[model samples]
Target: MISVGGYYCSGRSNGHHLQGVAMVISNRLQSSVVEFTPVDECIMVMRLKLAFGFMSLIVVYAPTDVCKLDVKEMLHAKVASVLDRCPQRDICVVLGDFNVVSGCDRAGYEMSVGPHGSGADAGSKNRLLFRDFARSQKLRISGSWYQRPNPLRWMWYSDVGNAAKKIDHILVSTRWRILQNCRVYRSAVVPIINWLWLPSGSISKLPSGPMITLGCFPWTG
Candidate 1:
């Protein structure tokens, strides 16, 4: 565990220098952290003691769209195994840059996606895989639950500034009402990132739940 500016960070570095995943918790809630496990360079798990039971947080940097299908499936399988081991009573949240565009069509995926996604109508291989994973796990895409402008949904942009894609996402348990709002901030000099605010009283006694941030960086195939 490492502390920086009153925040505790946990993660695994695979020596690639360009790939890794981490979770940062505010010092105010440091006492709540009961376990932190680094699954791999691309995944990390953190458990926090909550008023009711526990909150399991999985931070992941999934394979890009260009990667082979088998490679992408492997990461999802690893995440699934981790989720299976969590306590049934724990609040599970899977958040990260999944690098897939889960379009707004809720057709058969009513359990996983909401009514407000922005992307391709006909699902791509990556999109379909991501959606199936969420559906199988009974998790909802947090950003799609709340309505936002289409532009705000785009989480990645091209270097030429002519194209943008909604790849980064935060998936939460379909049963929890913890997230109040999710906002994306676009900057000319930095890659897009999302800020999620947990409303007061959502997480039992923890009135001020930890604010979660998901960031996406440019990647080349």
Candidate 2:
């Protein structure tokens, strides 16, 4: 395994050999890390000391629509536990490949989600689960708030390559204002593509104080 940053933490799953979650703490940010907890292959939490107080960043990879209901429920439970542990006053940012398409319907979820979301799939239970989590945690769906071009909004494409959907997302506390510049950067290429190429869906930036950048890429076998 190649290591780029200084501190590395990971959680591996026994059932699926390739299923795992990891976080690489940059040397510059290493000193701010209060604690890092890897709940399982699908979830991890990192607490950092900020100028104001503390900040909790929870990264997750939820099961896709094909996964069983029990699997999705378990993942949500694990994520909720981590959020519950975070102090209420601290800023919380939950992000990653949710694998759920939150449609552009902001009827009842006007405060939590925006109307700029991509079209949603009718049969995805993951969508409902995500909405519930956002409501419970009082977190706003950061990705859905920005109005961008169609290509920038879609984070996943159909296998046949005809259609696209916004499956990945970044959810942050509503207290922070999501700048208009926050958008998904599609077609971004890594410098080491000559030796090892990875498909990247989007690069999202939280252009707030100090600034935080997050990238979402799914691994395909």
Candidate 3:
């Protein structure tokens, strides 16, 4: 069984339009969902009760690099607001299609991003903002820390241009030394393009266990 969550386009009298963000949770994990909130069409936050404490998961679909600067700023502000409200002790994990590339620049940002990023630098303001946000939150981009093959690292591929980019990401709070491994999950038969796996582990000998496996696919339709 699968539990899906997201914002659905409202049906109007003129026509039915559906352009929104969504997340699916398996039945085994559904029981842990404490609450979920839809911040807007582009963002959603879900909380889950763990064995020892709680965890906050934020899912976002940011505007593309071509969008107006104000639009991108507004979205980030909204996301930050939601993040501020989360409990300080809760393990926070942010994941989604950020539409921004962190690249392989792991100079001063060694704490936030890693060296396994892909694609050329488009010099997008969104990318800068995302990096700054991660730094401010003390969150580490989990996928970037590990080295993977080119095809496995890139989350978005342009068929027309024959280009691939690593725009999707999974971030975890630095305080929790819980993320054991993170990588893109690819399969010939599955429709899911990006998947993150976090194995169960104890935190500070507190037995704060919750093995979270998340899969995300870009909404093309």
Which candidate leads the pack in lDDT? Answer: 1
In candidate 3, what are the lDDT values of residues 147-219, reduced to their tens digit?
8776667777788968877788888888877566777666621112222223444555434345567655433
lDDT score, residue 111, model 3? 92
CA lDDT of every candidate: 0.71, 0.65, 0.70
Give, for candidate 3, the lowest lDDT window spanning 10 residues.
188-197
Mark the 10 consecutive residues where model 2 has the least summed lDDT: 189-198
Q: Over the full model, what C-alpha lDDT does candidate 2 score relative to the true structure?
A: 0.65
lDDT digits (tens) for residues 155-214 of candidate 1: 787999998877778788887765566657665322222333345444433455446443
- The segments of candidate 1 whose C-alpha lies over 4 angstroms from its true place after superposition are 1-18, 187-221
- Model 2 ranges with Cα > 4 A deviation: 1-9, 13-17, 178-181, 187-210, 216-221
**C-alpha root-mean-square deviation, candidate 2:** 7.8
Ranking by TM-score: 3, 1, 2
**Model 2 lDDT tens row, 3-115:** 24544334464544466554555565677788777666677777887554666878787898889988998888888888888888767878778888777677777778876
Candidate 1 vs 3: which has more TM-score? 3
